[model samples]
Target: MAKIKALKCKECGREYPVEPLHVCEFCFGPLEVEYDYDEIKKNISRDKIKKGPVSLWRYVDLLPVENPTVGLNAGFTPLVKAENLGKELGLNNLYIKDDSVNHPTLSFKDRVVAVALSKAKEFGFDTAACASTGNLANSVSALAASAGMNCYVFIPSNLETNKIIGSLVFNPVVVAVDGNYDDVNRLSSEVANEFGWAFVNINLRPFYSEGSKTLAFEVAEQLGWKTPDAVVAPLASGSLYTKIWKGFNEFKKVGILEENEKMPRMYGAQALGCSPIYKAFKEGRDWITPEKPDTIAKSIAIGNPADGPYAVKVTRESNGDMEVATNEEIIEGIKLLARTEGIFTETAGGTTIAVLKKFAEKGVFDKDEVVVAYITGNGYKTMEVLEGHLNKPIHIKPTLAEFKEKVVGQTINK
Candidate 1:
């Protein structure tokens, strides 16, 4: 009655014992943790989950770890009923899965790092590491420090300044590579091989990716055990997007969701400057052609996504579409979410919001259809992206006369 069966290859269906492995020897395809869902069904139920801890670990029956020791407080972020945002978008049933406040790191990466590091510890690894754009770096640094493990995080040199500081404060050895995210990942792979460090997204990826399924689990439970009609989530390496789709299906497989409930259509969002998944989806192709990263949304600016093909497959299977947003549109999307829902999200979230708007405008959703848009990180990490795009503050003195003339007068005129 083992919860996890093996690390099964995504292609060629090869199976290997659970270890810090991510690729198949025979096919070189990615490996994923295969579970014994029938065993899970006998042990899991709504009441069991409800009585568990109020965190991602509450769904421990589904995650790849047996005892999750890192990022204990991560996940179970708020699923806000976006009444204001819904009205603005002309949709009545819209929600925002706000992971901007996810514990320890303030991003969805916390969930994955939690599982990854926990599994790494179980595998007798002393060091935790990852190649990141921003959020993953911050998560690995913070969580690994909390777990008392030696940590190293690699990221592109040009990542946002605040993100670099976010990792630095956690005291992990941070490596700033001289290229884009893909380059950083390549270096991390070599380092993981050379040093035998548990790179969370590399050698430990089969376990790390399972953490993202908790987002889907939380959303379904939060929505009263019903899956949404559609979901719009940002795509970086496309892991999060595909895992979310997997989560909903898993719930159904475990009998947690009602037999009458339907799966959600999965919409993938990307920035116009780097949109290999969107390009592949639109052109009716199944494979991704890598693009050079060139977007303000640096977090989701992956040129070559490891899970890009799976993401496209899920989108097509779910009857969903992929879309990209320009820098201008991404900025507006951030502002719109802030103004309407009071949620200040990073560029990744802005990309999601913008694509959600496009889906709404294109009549992709009915008026009463349930839609959930994921906001993955806090805007504070990437505030520089909004520079000169927001209005300058009204520089009024302590005088009420100046306030009335410069602020109140202008307010009234507008």
Candidate 2:
């Protein structure tokens, strides 16, 4: 494992010792993990990575943990060519970095939870916790179970039923707060400080976020070690978007990708109900103004995102744009992907696909440019939202007459 040299404050440039800390005591800004890239470049190579495990642990050289207890099978999801979707949108080259099929938990949160729990164990903590909208709670609960650690997951009370049950099945103590995700996060932060337990998103954030980089790594490798022209990812707290940018840069620094390779435009997708980052980007502001989320895409419904500013910075720095999808658009996007690619994704993925279509319609993408859109979760977890929206199946009698009359493409008389 590549040892972290320090935890550097993103705003003030102050460095602190490697420990379970997130905020800078002096500046109150978030801190990020700084690794010794020189040491990593010594033995980290494409051949070494390809020879490693078939999971996210294949990039263990870049991850923070030495012995990952949980996610030995979390990363390296498929980067499908998306020919059907591309044809529908009139784009020649498009791909979907599908994480909806991720193991243990059918979402990208499994990647981050794997690293966080490993570090929690490495730090000798037996309790794991987090504040989540939905997917993070499920990932944390499942991984903590595998690691034999006590787990607590705090989430918004209005989360989908399957999401609540998904975490409960893992046997974690689940807390449903009365308010929104931001409210749950605030209480979790206090509990993290008061109870002295490792809250993955609050205290162990720097290490946990490194897990998102594997998404970028898999994309570049799947594209034959080349960065795409653009990438569209759903923005919740915005940590995932920024980390993907960091991941591409890290690969270039380590000689995996060429130093002169053009970086991908880091596009962000959000629900119109809660799009602080998109609002900031549109108004040409450097800071974010919080909003109250009311979208069906509850997973990316953080009204006050902690990493909103950084997400804006990364988007501008990479010459990227952000877009929002309405509730109707989100639902259509979910059905579109299912009909075209046979991938049934949650609202977060729907938001991504909807934004991708908007961008394509606006001619934002070159016909030949490689565009990769991320689908972060499976639709099965949030099937409740599809009620009264999807086309109902046909009902027929169990007879050959009915089979010929209604089942074999027979026109129904209404």
lDDT of 2 by residue, 175-275 (tens): 99999999999999999889978899999998999999999999999999999999999999999999999999999998899889999998999999999
Name the lDDT of candidate 1.
0.95
Output the number of the lDDT-best candidate.
1
Q: Quote the positional error of residue 403 for candidate 2 in Å.
A: 2.1
lDDT of 2 at 371: 98
Give the CA lDDT, 0 to 100, for residue 122 in model 1.
Answer: 92
Tens-digit lDDT track of model 1 for 144-218: 999999999999999999999999999999999999999999999899889989999999999999999999999
- Clashes found in each candidate (C-alpha, N, C closer than 3 A): 0, 1
Worst 10 residues of 1 by lDDT: 405-414
Model 2: runs farther than 4 Å from truth?
A: 409-414
Clashing pairs in 1: none
lDDT of 1 at 145: 93
